[model samples]
Target: MNNYYILGLDIGSVNISAAIAKFSPDSDNLSISGIGRARTNGLKKGVVTNIEKASTSIRQAAKEAMKTAGCKPDRVVVSIAGAYTGSVKSQGIVSVPSGEISINEIKRAMQMAQDNAIIDKDQVILHVLPYEFKVDGQDHIEDPIGMSGSRLEVFTHVITAEGNSIRNLIKATNMAGLKIDNMVLAGYASALATLTKDEKELGVGLIDLGGATCDIVVHLGNSIVYNDTLPVGSTNITMDLSRALNTPLANAEEIKINYTKLLESGVSELQLPTMGEVSLTHEASMDIVTKVIYARIEETILLLLNKFENSGYLNKLGSGLVLTGGMSKLDDIRNLTSLMFDNIPVRIAKPRSVDGLFEVSEDAKNSCVVGLCLYGSGEFTRYEIDSNGELKYKDSHLKSMTSTKSVNSAPVIEKEKVEYKEDKSEDLIKISKISEKNAEDMHTFTKILNRLKQLF
Candidate 1:
């Protein structure tokens, strides 16, 4: 039996988490094998600032996970976040040949979208998610193939990131002796772990409040329509507490994590420990702490709301907001978010349906890493470490099918020439019809022939 081991590595400003899982070819199920976590020092706002420190953290975390799982993994699917990531919605249109749309035509339309996207030279495309397809003048066509149409148009959300930031992250991971199989946006990964199919289909917003960055992704019409990251996150709250209370940074973090509460009923006074003291050695008015924390959190929420408004989808989120990340564990966060967003239904999201032994701390903070594992189990891409210790994409294959799968188990296979069978039970219709020539290779010729016949 062929078994594939996969790893998900999430490198954050405050912590690095690793999740290991195994995909058995016969069962197509990804079973949890092990997990590891370590404090990170080299990243600031999810970007690698010190390669050495980041590499050390990655190495330590992977080693610990390998030890726990009793199996070493060479490749990992990494999660990328920070302010450098950006996304834009673009559309592409192409004339269909023979009045029938095929998978090749869809690819061409997608390629046109990519070609038409105005991206900076210093940025790299991360993901291209199709929002909707249109045949002729009709809209909302999810599967345009096998449909009769003269023109096919596709709307896509293209994600891009700063080239330098991505390079730094890759270099650090390579230095740590781990090859990256693929990279996923942190917001999208978290949404995969926490969001339900109904929320995604009915339109929803996901806010991931990490230590140093807040990531947002909006889903509408069963696709991601908007994604962006803000520099402000829960760390700002700690900093405000530290500056206002004249406390050390470490002590401020402790208070923010342990003592700070979002009190909806508005408590008048509360007891907290003094600076440098472990016990409750001092009494501080709850109003003061409330002001400090609320100021920053409110600012963050307003910024996110402003972005959502600018995107023109603030009113369309029928499912409201889902919050996750390190700060989502804070007391009364759901209440605060609901109040700030005009009582829009708000809920704290955590990794669900996990099959492994996870610590209490892994509840909310480990969503990205666990989502990465889930993403890998559904995809069939291979990465290998080269002689120079750099991660290189080797090939793509069809991942084995499994019976027990979650809503997030959709395969993420890249565009490659691989044999696949038609499964009528699945949502995505597989292209099982093939000729002697590969679909990609014959696309242009087929289109030209059809055009010539029309001219004749």
Candidate 2:
């Protein structure tokens, strides 16, 4: 009967999405409890512009999720994306005094690698993911612990962001009456929810196209090698359409969303509801819309491709590309991307293996938030929210946990035992089925208990 809840909030330029999941002590699985979303304001290109407006959006989204889950969450794992987000790789080597690598030696090597990294004074490290360990010049050693080697070396990919940007996000979330549990790069989170084990192992690229930003992460050897965020995204296309067609922003958005289908239909003309029933011909409207959309999307994709090429990992990607987020849902985008990438394999990614409210679990736009929940299920640092809505670190180092002590009577469980293995597809399939069944059976009880717990 012991259950724990975890909340993941994705604050983006276009919208704020929140997802709540219940973790059970007896099972290493996450059951979706509720999901909520609200239109976002006060932000542009994933950076907070107005704290009060951003806080209001976050509060509204969280409140809707809390009402659906029937419990209030004091803390949340949040997703961050912007042009300032980036990653760099560094290597560290240390001599093992004992001639055998121990955990301490590994930690020291990682520390050395982190110290060797060159970062700006205003930047803060978000994640230091070790790609591999080498023992005595031997490469590809997954773990060096207990290995007899005079020297231990570690290669790590470190993610960093502008410190002020992070502070702004923290300030907005705090004002929303929620404490930050952990912050994950939006690209990393989306990859967690969409990219499969095979794709990651064989080398792949994930592109999360949001409203105002395009987040890119490259994975190889089952680890992140490079990540960056571009300032341009789907909103640019909408703006282009708005300007080229001389239409309102709302109407332009509608056209952009349906542009592909409209083009495919080969209609000569269309009537506009916004223009007082004025009829627009394809030669005038569709061509302009197509040209605007194509130009912007092409520019964005080329820029991303150039970044990948510059990273020197472009040739290493065997799985090609997996696209997710709101823009990926656009009709014909897959073909468009494929053509741009010279027919490299491209597929639109949807959230899978997530047992939750149907809409959120299946939506590409919710990938980051859902992935935040999945990321929070693993080992992470803990933060505390004071009564006055301030965030404080509970510890300096990352902590591992199997359950969370709720702020009230509700117990929260963490799915620490659940591990995703590349060769264990059958196991994952079985687990997915079991989770789905559990979700179905617990549907009623979850609603009732959540409502009851709200009274406390």
Candidate 3:
């Protein structure tokens, strides 16, 4: 059984994570073979501050994962943070020379859309996601291939990132001895791992609150309509606590993760160490810590709310908000987010289930990495822009389905043929019995006629 292997790398400001997935085409099953994470100090928000340090971090994480999997992957799908990324909407139209839409025409339409989009000179297109298609004058067509049409058009969401930032990331990955197969938006990757089909169709909002950045994506209908990133994240809260309590940043991070309650109303006491001297400690009120954490979280949520409102998709979120990433583990985050968003439903989500994903699936922080693996396995949209920046139809799974049937159909057809022959044999037996009965009647008629002749 041939299997496909791919590694997913999520390079974050605070940490870098890598996961290996093995996908079996015969069974259509995806399984996680290994997972790795390492502390990183090379990135601030989404920008690579030090390529050497970032490359070291990536190498460590990938090495650990490869050790566990007992094999090294030739290529990887990596996540690009949303901080340095932006998207624009554009449309493309073309006259179909074949008078019908095919892969070539679809690719041309997507290329036209990319060419037509107005992008900054310092940025490059990462994805051209065509959400809606039109054939001739008809609109809202999802797939135009195999359909008769004189004209083909596509409406796309073009995701672009700063050229320098992208180059830096690619360089770091190359320095780590890894080749990148695809680069995905961090927010979209998290959404793919955590969101259900119903949530996506019903319109949902996803927020990936990591250490130094909060990435947001609004998925509506069949594709993401809007995405943005905020520089503030859970790290802001830790900084606030450190300043307010005169504690070390590491201690403040520990306190923020373990002590603060955002929605609690009770007061408590705590002991915190001073910034430079671990031996020097002082009493601090839990109320102060809670107040500081709440202030930062509220600010982050408010900023996100403003972005959502401006996106023109605020009212379209039927599935409300799904919160993920490391920050989502905070106590009562959902309650606070719900209240701030006017009581629209809210839930904290982790990565969806995959086979052999034991510990990693339990944390929301792994959503992006896991989703990257899924994307590598062709679990993303039906149509996607390839690494060459050209839109391609992903029909491998469909081809697998057809291949499976072709392999299995012969036996099934043969069984049906055998059953059909048995039925035919039963009909022949019934006909033979009827023939015998007819012969008996004929013989009885002849005897009656003979008896009548003798009487005469």
Candidate 4:
């Protein structure tokens, strides 16, 4: 059991789940030794509204995981998702030095594009993904490393969010007594664990339906081409059910899981009371509740469709939508989603391996946690610290802003990854998804602070 130890923690609205990896470095396959989970009470819609409350939930979950793993988790990777998360596209280009394009030139172009695209002062750029590069007149090139060209142009997908929201998340996590080793974008984490290389290369739309947020990621031609977060999630379905059935929220959720309806049943002959959990005096057909629930789910789908269509990724989809997350466990979910998008195949997906627990309907739910372990195990980006203890990018490849003085020069290369479970001493702590309990809602922040703010 001492093979290789890595901890992955996924903080969600409904539950906090963790996994300890028993690394079999001698083989390709991995085993998850101890999986721990606890109910989450301090979060709302995937964001921490109350730091103290959120911290309590995280600490409880971590403590359980630590006991199971038989050791304290000195280093951890946390997932981040909030209402402020969003995406946009940008392009960068540079004349080929000596009328010829090299791998370095292409890399420089990507950095330029990311630097040029960031317009908000308060927003923090999370991921700078170089989707594709065009060398001279040739296009659709995934890598032009050995190719020759007169100019190199790059198109990238930029994902960003409110900086304060991210800071709040970090603060709460620190308060919970866990040192975060890495910060991974939640949707990307989900994709890496669930999406096949072919699916990502051929272009697929991954829709992860969560409790409070529906995340949309468009992976096409090898990288994520677009991403966005919709405020609506599975919780909306519960709310709609409660309102339509005139029952309490808890009972509505119970009915959603326990009830069933024939796909073509234009009418539900079953009777349900509108007032309470255990009332039978008045009987109303159950069809109304089902249809109402279906309608709300459809609207959320439509919202995603609109985002995809408007982003021009609708036509580029070669691989159809892949849906996952705890919310994707609903019965006949594919059938309901199929009707919303024309000719698009919809299916539930889950983590391929390293499993012990999986609810039949929680394809999307496991993706993030599983992906976090996979991400921490594999090296993606690197970060460093200054005398002041602030976080700084270890490599130029990850810099959001290209320094004017260093733009034309080749940046220094560092030694590849070496393990260190050091605490983040004075690094930036991320707080995300400002809910009502966080003292100010995102809407309120946006309205009051009309001035633009810049962040890394």
Q: Which candidate is the best by lDDT?
A: 3
Local distance difference test, per candidate?
A: 0.71, 0.71, 0.78, 0.64
Poorly placed runs, candidate 1 (over 4 Å)? 98-100, 260-287, 358-362, 379-456
Once superposed on the true structure, which residue ranges of model 2 sit more than 4 Å away at CA?
97-100, 260-268, 273-287, 379-399, 402-456
Model 2 per-residue lDDT tens digits across residues 1-456: 455677899988888999897765456677678888999988877888898899899999998999999986534788878477766777777788888776667666665665556565656666667777788889988656679988877788877777667667766776777766667778888988888878888899999999988898988773687897778789898888766766667888888887778878997565544433356422345766767887887888899888788878888889899999999977677888888887889989887666657677677888898888876565221222111112222232123232234321111111112233223122220010001113245568765654343222
lDDT of 4 by residue, 226-287 (tens): 77778888778888887876777876777666655433455555455556546553444676
Error of 2 at 131 (Å): 1.0
Best-to-worst order by TM-score is 3, 2, 1, 4
* Candidate that scores best on TM-score: 3
lDDT by residue (tens digit), candidate 3, 1-456: 567677899989888999998877778788899899999868888689998889899999999999998887644789989989998898878778767678888777776666567666666677778788888789878678899978887888887778668767876876787766678888888988999999988989999999999999988776787889988888888889999999999988988777535235354777779988869999898878878877888888999999888999989999899999999988778999999999999989999889986788998999999999887776777676643353446676445433332221101100011222222122110000001112245577765653343222
Per-residue lDDT of model 1, residues 1-456, tens digit only:
566677888888888988888767566566678888899979888888898899999998888888889997634778888477887677778888688887667767776665456665656667667778888889988667689989888888877777668767776776786766667888877887888888988899999899888889998864678998878878888888877776667767876786535365566654555666665455567667777877777788888878888878889889999999988877677887888789999988887666556552258888888788776665311221111112222222323222222222212222222333223222331111112223355578766754453332
lDDT: which is higher, 1 or 4?
1
For candidate 2, the TM-score is 0.79
TM-score, one value per model: 0.78, 0.79, 0.84, 0.74
- Candidate no. 4 TM-score: 0.74
> How far off is residue 416 in model 2, in Å?
32
> After best superposition, candidate 4 residue 86: deviation in angstroms?
2.0
Worst 10 residues of 4 by lDDT: 408-417
RMSD of each: 10.0, 15.2, 23.3, 9.9
Look at candidate 3 and give me any clashing residue pairs.
Answer: none
